[model samples]
Target: MEQIQRSNWKFNMILLGMVLLLIVSIIYSITLGSADISMKDVYQILFAKITGNNALLEGFEKGWIDIVWLIRLPRILLAVFAGIALSLSGAVMQAIVNNPLADPYILGISSGASLGATLAILLGVGISFGPNYVGISAFIGALSVSFLVLLFGSSSSRADVSRLLLVGIALSSLCSAISSIIVFAANNRNGMMTLNFWLLGSLSAANWQIVKILAPIVIVISIFFCFQSRILNLMLVGDEAAVTLGQENHIYRIVYIILAAILIGFIVYACGIIGFVGLVVPHIARLLVGVNHKRMIPITILFGGLFLLWADILSRMIIKGVEIPIGVIVSIVGAPFFLYLVIQNSGERRQ
Candidate 1:
């Protein structure tokens, strides 16, 4: 009992710490960018906005309000919510497939989104959707590919881990080839540049409109996944074991994959394809807290949010006047961490 209490106490402490860190990170990130805004000014604008008290805005410059409220804060919040969505999807995928290698992109969702965005930019497909057509197309592509994956993987029997992964890889290759062909045949330099940027990912286009759409979806899905923690834990134990425990692993697997795909689709729609967070954050969470989804899910969400928030800050400040692609930054950081985890896991298996 004492040991259990100690564990619970430690978990709560870490959770609180993560929440505070995320808050601080957002405040600090708001102070970055080309415009020079002080922490005091940032807070004043935020307070005024929150309280609807123009009195709090008296001493602040108008530009600071616009920059903080219209520009920086939206991007930061998008990063936070995007991180949460991606990481939770990763955590759930890993458990469902019982493979640490499983991530949101592992199922070809990113490739599909890239294809959709490519078609939209290069050929003006889906232009009728207005200014955000590219994102809308990407979401449609992701959802379509997700359904195909589930359909094909489960055609023979229950969609086992190996079968599902194979289907995902095959479809991913097909999507990538199609995207390449479209880019090559279009011969539009501007379209190619746009496609490259979307493929690499960026939070530069973030605004309140995006945050409003993505934030609520991410929060609701995250809470829903939290309630499925017990089932997720069972999934990691293998299908036979789960069946013996009276859990219908296949039904749950299908549902989880669909839910994860929806989360990824929306995130891809909002921020393009920011990789590595989904793949690495969950493993990092597993290391910090054990494999219990109940404890691990919350921590994964917080860490993922903090990780991306800082990554966005670095992307903006890494080179003056030139913002690096956020996806590239994540891959640079995530690649090393992923390698280390693989090597460490391999060494442990050998031992």
Candidate 2:
């Protein structure tokens, strides 16, 4: 009992630290925009906006207020949701596939989304969905591929990770080929530029409307997966062993994959396919808290949120007035870190 109590206390402390880190990181994200807003002003603006109280910023200038409320706040909120969604889904995907290399986009979901958005931009196919048509198209692409992967991978008597991965690769290649044909045929520079930006990813167009669409989808999926930690742990131990322990690994595997796809689709719709937060944050969480899903899930979410918030800031401020693509920044940083992790893990496996 004493040992259990001690363990519980340590877990609680880590949770507390993570909460603080999130709060600090959120404030840091708000404070470090291009216009040089102070931390106190950010706090007052946020509090006043949330509470519907103008008294919080009675003396502030109108321009500063507009910058905080109209511009930066929505962008930051989008980043928060995108980060949480990506990181949590990554952790869940790692568990679903029982592979450290697994990410939410592993099964070509990102490629599918890219294809959809590219086609929509270059060909104007999803114009019926209004200004947000590209995002909707991307979501559809991701979900379609996700369902197909599950359908093909689960027709057998057993669940096969490699089979699902192969299906994803094939489908992704098809999507890529289709998208490439459209891009090549369309001789319009503006359309090609729009497609390229969608592929690179950014939060410049983020708004309160997009936040409204993203929040509920990501929150519901994240909460649902959090409770499935037990099943996820069973998955990590393999299907045969899970069946021996009275767990239906194949059923849970399909469910997890679908759930991951939904989350990934929503994220791609929200942020245009930001990578690495899913792949990188989970590994760091696993290092800190072992392979336990319950603890790692939330930690991964918080740290992922923090990581992307800073990444967004860097993307915006790294080159003065010009904004860098968030995807490019993440890839640049994440590739080196991923290589290091690969080397370290290889050494460990050798040992």
Top-scoring candidate (lDDT): 1
Task: Please give, for residues 22-138, the per-residue lDDT of candidate 2 as tens digits.
Answer: 787777677776687788887898899889998888989888888888878788888888888888878877787676765656667777777777777777878999987977788
Q: What lDDT score is found at residue 88 in candidate 1?
A: 93
Model 2, position 183, has a per-residue lDDT of 77
Query: 175-198 in candidate 1: lDDT tens per residue?
Result: 878987888898878767766776
- The global Cα lDDT (0 to 1) of model 1 is 0.84
- Give lDDT per model, in order: 0.84, 0.79
Poorly placed runs, candidate 2 (over 4 Å): 1-3, 55-61, 126-133, 150-159, 162-174, 344-351
Give the C-alpha miss distance for residue 144 in model 2, angstroms: 2.3
**Residue 251 lDDT (model 2):** 71
lDDT for model 2 comes to: 0.79
Q: Best TM-score goes to which candidate?
A: 1
Candidates in order, TM-scores: namely 0.91, 0.88
How large is the C-alpha RMSD of every model relative to the true structure? 2.4, 2.7
